[model samples]
Target chain A: MKTLKIIKIGGNIIDNEAALSSFLEVFATINSPKILIHGGGKLATQLANQLGLEVKMIDGRRITDKATLDLITMVYAGKINKNIVAELQSKNCNAIGFSGADGNTIISKKRPVKPIDFGFVGDVKKVNIETLQVLLEHKVTPVFCALTHDKKGQLLNTNADTIASELAIGFAKYYQTELYYCFEKNGVLRDVSDENSVIREITTQSYQNLIDDKVIVDGMLPKLNNCVHAIEKNVYKVCIGKPEMLYDDKANFTTITK
Target chain B: MKTLKIIKIGGNIIDNEAALSSFLEVFATINSPKILIHGGGKLATQLANQLGLEVKMIDGRRITDKATLDLITMVYAGKINKNIVAELQSKNCNAIGFSGADGNTIISKKRPVKPIDFGFVGDVKKVNIETLQVLLEHKVTPVFCALTHDKKGQLLNTNADTIASELAIGFAKYYQTELYYCFEKNGVLRDVSDENSVIREITTQSYQNLIDDKVIVDGMLPKLNNCVHAIEKNVYKVCIGKPEMLYDDKANFTTITK
Candidate 1:
């Protein structure tokens, strides 16, 4: 069977140029077909500061008002997206950077708020797998940023983790691909602060225990959610681990299976 | 009439950090309501070369085969677009970078080639002025790069000049905005080699003469065509000049009038 992978890198990984270059080198060596999705929170926050635009957050989710939405759109879809593609090319990796907005690759609907408006934040409603598969067939790596378009043709900021999950599910259904979530941490740790104590594997039952103990907070919550979503959608495997530990046989990580 | 302006910067201008900063300083001082569109040919070509991908050109238009199209989309839509927005913000300019793909701000039709397929090149067919206007109303400067989407949901590479022209026409019709085409050259010169011998103004008759004499060639041809199109579309004024001469009383440039 042909191997397909969805690799996700977050804001911490993408914000550092040197780290991005190092990640690209490792990514180029992967023999299987892959798609990359990235986040751009650092860049967006910096831009917001410069523009005197307030960065509002509601429960860790960015309140994407008009100004914040524009800022994120520019940073995620424009800067971080292209920088990754350029880095991949520097390593002789054939990579193409894109976003949810491209060719309607990811269509979504605006999350209508009851009291406060989200301006342009979208919940992923659909994914166009055929377009992505065509590029992958030509050995081109599809690098995507988390920016989607609503049904009314408005650009909306979406979470990178969510976007990657949706894409993994879509690819899993379309081409039976595996999903890998790579980040700075060493998967889900038994002790929240201990990086070396990586959990070897996780099931639906154990996942709830970790959450009930309040160990998974902030960024890790969404990542776990994505993993569950991918597994439920019948992906071959959903691996969560440190970037370098991906290839290690004994690397501490969590593998989610249905 | 509200003096709205659209300024287009060549891809060459933002080749490096120093050049980008220099341009941003000048860009920050402009008081008029404006929109920015930029090109990223050099960066795209460099990335393509590193990946050992063949860059094809036909009739002076890029043949965006799978590899080339992906590289162009990533570089133009991502890196160049965000960098400009960041630079502008650093200078206290509220700028928002985007692409034709965003919110379907610019919709296009794939350039149908029968003999030799240009996989992802698009000819723009429509512009979503309402989306842009909404951003503008919120005091956000919309910075666009040259990339669009086809109806079939494919990301297509469109010409930067074409994007600027279409945007100028749209803004003019929708908001009565002025259009300025700024480049390295002082203006449309009478002698191609002599930069100082700028043609102050050119009527349709003189423009035809220049075209007949083979004076306009390469990159300038499309720009000239765009200028003529904007003028014909009833834009308030279409000026072709150096960035420095944009607001000069005796600016050495060419103005196209209907």
Candidate 2:
């Protein structure tokens, strides 16, 4: 199978212009077929504040009301995504940006409101791998923003991590897919404060033990679970670390396995 | 040659929700390979007002400084483009939205500051017909927002009508292309105020006569000139009128010829 890398970058890197430019320089150098997924940065919240739209959050997840969704659609899908594509193009990377609605590349369902209404938030329903494959085959690198649609004229807010995992799993059937999640952290740390305390490898069993010992709690749990989910779904490799890990094979990043 | 329809819809129709939905329904029924280009509506100006950004204009044309360019990028490429794509999808049309940056499908140069400084504005430099043809061949309808980019990582605000004309001229090489400009007016009116005085046919020589007779002046002059330019560039047909003319065969619209 052809090797393909699916890398997801969080807002921390995106919010910093210098860091984003440095990361794109490395991204342009990657040899294999690659896909990029990005999350909306603090700009959305800042804009919401300016526009007098309240930012509602429950358990660290955003409650995407209609206004919030529109704001993100404007910020994430529009400004950030296009800027990245133009930057990549300047580097001759031939990048094309996407929202889930574009070509119906990713169709999602609105989150159920039994517990609490998440407004326009959506969960991944399907990934149109064919459209992606065709783009990749034509040497067009796809950049995706964390927004999906319900296929009924509604654009829904979605999780970037889940989108990366789902896309990796979707393409895993046809390619040797490697999923990478890049954040501010160097890796999943044994000591959250000590940057050097990177866990080189993590298996499902070790993940459970880490939870029992309280080493992995709160926010880290859902993220780690998503990594494990992709691994079990036949993704050849899953890595969570800083952006530098993409070009540095010797880099110590947390690798996930089932 | 396969026929391709390139339709450009102005802001008045886009700004009205009922009219937009009605137009999309008719657009969904276009049997040939089609592409839609839309102008940024008053939403950008409204947002600018809310954000306290000054709106600058020179003879009805927006002077796109960096901030205004970003605003339109967010409005045109982000919110408006995606919503239209989703709406078309709901109507069973596989529409994918693009800014010139996406797939590098359209490339432009920053308009030079000779007489007046139209900051961050771009003129259409090139359109990647191969990329467009590939998308069309795969049954994907492309919807373009009026934003293009300089190769050096800068996004520029562009005029939608010119983009449509250029695209029609670009695609004319591979397909029998027809360009349509849909605005609020039914057609170019012989009497500016009379709705029934639609000029059914306008030849290049007649166009000159209309201009000399002061019948075609002001905003309509540039628009009709663009239509004539497209016809001169080998685009098979060019029409200017309301959106309904797209689906209604008996509908009278202004047709341009050389």
TM-scores, chain B, all models: 0.93, 0.97
Candidate 2 has an interface RMSD (Å) of: 0.8
Deviation in Å, model 2, residue B251 alpha carbon: 0.8
The DockQ assigned to candidate 2 is 0.84
| CA lDDT, every model vs. true structure | 0.74, 0.91
Candidate 2 chain A, run of 10 with poorest lDDT: A58-67
Candidate 2 lDDT over A41-145, as tens digits, reads: 898988888888878998777788888888999999999999999999999898888889888988999989979898998999999888778889988899999
Chain A TM-score per candidate?
A: 0.93, 0.97
- Model 2 reproduces a share of the real contacts of 0.76
Encode model 1's per-residue lDDT on B1-258: one tens digit a residue: 667788888865767567667767887778777888888848777656655677787766568887676566656776567556645655656665566655356778887787767777889999867656755665557788888765343567888878988998888866677778777788888797898888888776778888888877777788899998888887788888877666568668878876
Model 1 ranges off by over 4 Å: B1-258
> Candidate 1 iRMS, in Å?
13.4
Candidate 1, A15-53: lDDT as tens digits? 777787778789878888888888784867765665567
Best by lDDT: 2
TM-score (chain B) for candidate 1 is: 0.93
Which stretch of 10 consecutive residues in model 1 chain A shows the poorest summed lDDT?
A: A82-91
